[model samples]
Target: MSSAADSNSDGRRNRGMLKSYYTQGENSGDKQFDLDDSSFKPDQYLDFLLKKSSLNELMHQEEEIVQNIRSLDSEMQTLVYENYNKFITATETIRKMKSDFGQMEEEMKALSENMDNICDLSSSVSDTLQQKRSGIRKLAGVHTLLQKLQFLFELPARLKKCIEMEAYNQAVRYYTRARAVLNQYQHMPTFAGISQDCGSIIYELGNALKEKLRDSEASSKQLAEYVDLLLQLEEPADSLCDEYLISARSRVDEKVQELEDVLEDNSVDILEFVDIGCNGVLSNVSLLVVAYNDMFLNRAKANTELDSIALQKVSALVKEILHKFFELIQKRVQLEKQTGDNAILVRALDRFHRRLQAMNKLLPTAELATLATEIVYNAAKDRIDHYYQALTDHLGHCITDIRQALAAPKLISSNLDENSSTPLQNLVQTSVSSLVEQIKAVLANLQAFIATDITFAMKSTFRRPFCFDGVREGLVVRFLRRMLEYLNELCEKPSGPATLLLLLSKLATILEESTIGYLLVLVDEQFLIVQEGDVQFTNPQTLKDEAKAAAKKLLNNYVRLEGQTLSHMVRKSVETRDWLNTIEPRNVRAVMKRVVEDTSSIDSQVGQLYDDMEEQKKDRGSDSTKRSASGLMKSSKTWSFTPSTTAAVLDNSAFMTNISKLFSDKIDIFSEVDASRASIMTGIIKIVLKTLLECVRLRTFSKYGLQQVQVDTHYLQMYLWRFVQDENLVHRLLDEIVSSSLHRCIEPSLMENSVIELICERG
Candidate 1:
């Protein structure tokens, strides 16, 4: 049993062992497979571990990145905030500046308003001055009327007194009263009445005296008859009565002797008294006659021991008085001729009128018209009737003498003709010549009178509205126009030596009155209209026509005068430039600016005249053919081509050279007048620059042979290369040309660079 049991145990052990071996093998296989799988699982585990670690790291990194991003965002936000703050500060500054500018604009507006107010104030002051002037004018008109009344009522009685007695005292009292009235009128607001009253009273008194003298003569004659009758009727007288009569006669004789002695001591010569009396009536006439007589006597006694200066003074006084006298007499004569009543007076007046008409024909219409107006104004009423009557009586006596001479058998028409030239012609010539001479002589006196009257009027209580320039210019223009007309008439006469000399004298008188020193300057400058050796007019119609034409021609001559004056002024100012420097810069600037503007205006007017001439030529259809014909015939034909030829020939260098030469000669480059220089240089420079620029552009573009393409480096380089080769020479030429041209063109004050740039852009 033990042995069997051992065998079984052995077998069981083997089986167990085998079983354990199989289990182990299964386990090993499982393990191997598991290992293989575990290997992948380890990799997976590692990957999982790595993934987990990576996940942890990624989470950490994500957290870190989020923080970093937040930090970066914060920094970016800070930067943006700072930038925004800066922008706001800049914007605030800009806004403040804008507000300040707005305030400045408001201030400027207020300043403008103040300027406007100042202008309004100035205007108000001007208006007030004008109103004051107007008020003064009304006062003068009323003063003239009072003078006329005094002349008519006072002077005749004093003149008619035969002796210095009670009548003379009464007349003197009346005259004194009239003079007091005149003085009172002069002191009043307006002296309107003084002139009229004085004139009328004197005239009326003169007439009244003549009537009084006649009445006195008649009374004396009647008294003489009565005294004779009384003497014849005388009866036998008592002794005592005779003794009384003798005593009375002795007393009367003694009184008469005393009176005679007194009269002899006090009395003047009869002729001297007569002269004094006449002088009182006609003040200017008597004085003038006396002066003339003195002058004549002085000349007759030229070799006497009298002072030459005194003689000259007498002659001057005579001339001055005669001028006044002639003016007064002419006025009176003209007045008388306008109105008359008697047939003889009427006939005399008619003859005088005819003579004036003939004179009017001889003189210029303008002068004649003025004279006629003056005559009409002086003779509007019957005041001149007495003078006309006197003239009629004298003329009637002359007519009677003429009639008797004609009726005489020895008298002949030929003799009459020999004695006098054709009465109408002779009278016209004489009267017209006399009038012209009188006008010349009176000019200085009239000027003095006008100046004195104007000064007095301005200061007087009865002041008239006056403008210094307006009144002076108006009077001067009127006087000059009248003078011009007279000169025209004189110029129409035949060029006789005497007539020529007379004309020169008259012209000299006009020069003295009008231009003074300026006329001599004009003559020196050869600015007068009269040329050397011009023919004088003879026939009346020819004279009239020539005068009219010459009058028109004077416009151009006057322009020359203005030009010369301006030129002289400019030259003088330039010469005295240093002196001008002392003046306020603004004032100098203003004066120079005004001079420039005036010069420009003159140039514009001259240009307008040229344009008008061109228009006239066009209207006449004479320019083209005449210009062409002249060009063809003239030596200057090559250069004096028409516009068409000019355009065609402009391409020719030689032609351009010739043209430039011609232009240079005709245009004064260095003219002191800015306008002249500006016009010429501007035109030439513009043409030359335009032509050169066009030529340059054309040549450059043609060389490229490119169209419709933007300029590129290659093309630019090619052009640049070619341009550079000639650049130095071209640049030098252009610099010289442009500099010289612009120097001539622009004002001296302008910058060269700026001018050049402007020319390049605009030329």
Candidate 2:
């Protein structure tokens, strides 16, 4: 309490001194300015000190602080001494552990050495026991050798007795065992005598087996036994069997020769020759399989059944024969390809497919049928592939001619003369004619192959899940698709004006339309039409339904493929920017006009077709009586009007329905020409508009030139309006063309000069 009172008194004195300094005017408005003032004296301010009582109080406070520091220093020394003792104790424990580990390691090393010594001692004892066991085994081997010798000595007598009794199985059993032993011991001096006797017995057994196998009069079972015995006797009868099978190939060769002669002699029908050749192959393969079994039954493993073996061998042999036959066919096809007689090759392929059907029926098992069918299918595919390549090659040659003609510059006349024989015109005509013939031939061949060969022959023979007739169809369809690609490439080039493009597009249009029609005809001819009162199709089975479905699928594919190709060709031609390639306006106009006229004519053919059909309907009405009489005369009295025989006569209604369906099926493709024409006209208009815009911006045309262009532009707008009926677009184009032309004629210079002349005249 006394210290508190003294501290309060000192604080009051310090406050008193601060109040005096402030009163000297550091913060006051009025201030004393006496030189004698302590606040104003600098030395007096530096001498700031506490009162004497305050100094005495501070010394007392310093003594207390010194005592507290001495107390903390003592506490720190105690903590340091305690922690140092703990650290020293931990160090001693670690040192002791290290010494103990060293001793343990030395004891472990001695224990390992002792174990090694014990293992060596036990191994020595084991070696001694092993020697004794080997001695016992050697004694046993000696006894086995004696027994083998005894068996070898008695084998010859036993074999002879078995052969005498015709116990071939027992003989085989004895011979197998004895031969195993003799071959095992032949290199040993102990069995030299037995080896010689065994060899002689083997020779005799082989001779007997050979004599038995050579007897062709033996039954199949008997021959099988002899073959087994010969295999046991180790003779070269395997080679003999192969030779026997090979001998049957001579018949194959003879048939092949006859077929070749038929191919050379057009007098012989190819279909008949194919039938004979295919039947010959089947018979030859069958006979060869039988002979192979008879000669090499033992070639099969011990557990394999004879029937299974026969099937396997027959399959393999059939594959071989088919391979060789297909090879010959391929060579002939190659020759036909070279001679440009693809028609004959196509017919041959068709006949071959028919023959393949016959052969498939002749096969005994599904597995064999599958193999044979696939083999022949692949062969046909290869041939068809080659045919497509030939078509492509021929087309390539024609395209070259077209390109050559295009390289030459010949103006097309405004008035098309039928007798004009310009080099380019003649060249295009010849090339197009040649290509048209080739395309027609290819289409016919493909149609023939698909309709007669695959649909009727192959598909009928092999059911679904095993048949690959679709592959053949796909081959031809895909080839047609590929040909369109080539045509598109040829037509897409910017080598000429729309004239060449127009011509090629027309050719493509012809091909597409004709192909569709041909396919429709094939479908109508090959598949059963849903005629009136057709009970067979009322509840169609899997086969009939599948056939119809396949036909529909083919038609769908044809439509899609043709539609895509036609649209692509038109678009590509329209986008071609080589408009300036032909500078003659008359020539350009003539080509464009021809294109427009061609499209109009093609569009008009639908009406013409309908008219023709109407005329036919009229003709048929007039001849209805005669047709009915002919039908009655042809109808069999015993034949009921079943689904197949019903509707022998086609009415105008049915014909019209078919024509409508045909049109509907191809509507997408048929509409492309009009669509393409509009697109091309728009493109041409855009090019003209672009040129007119450039002229207006550059201000390079005179009044007369602008007027002439305006007249021409008006004529063009009128012409294009016939194709495209977008009145707004036409108005916009006209506005821009006329406005820009006028702008170019009324230049800034002219405006300035006119204003100056008016101003000067007014002054």
lDDT of each structure? 0.35, 0.48
Off by over 4 Å in 1: 1-482, 485-538, 544-549, 565-596, 603-763
Candidate 1, 505-577: lDDT as tens digits: 3233334333433322332232112322443312224333433444333332333343444445444433433
> In angstroms, how far off is 678's CA in candidate 2?
8.6
TM-score of each: 0.18, 0.39
lDDT of 2 by residue, 1-763 (tens): 3444454456546765777676655653212222233335534332332333377766785687688668755655565566567768989999999999999999999999999999999999889887598888899999998897687778778877887887878877887887666777778875666668656766777677666655555544555566656666665653545433444555556666676666566454444555666666655555555555555553445335544655565566667767666665555544443443434544655556555655565555535445544544454455556666776787777766666655554433333333344444345456656755665565455444344434333453332211123322433344445555655554334344334444444445444445434543443344333334422222223323333333333223322333343334333433342322322121123333333444333222222111132333353354322111112112122324334533432233235435644644221212222313343333333333444444444544453444433433443443444433233354455545544544444221111222322332332
lDDT measured at residue 233 in model 2 versus the true structure, 0 to 100 = 69
lDDT of 1: 0.35
Candidate 1, residue 166: the lDDT equals 26
Name the weakest run of 10 consecutive residues (lDDT summed) in model 2.
626-635
Best model number under TM-score = 2
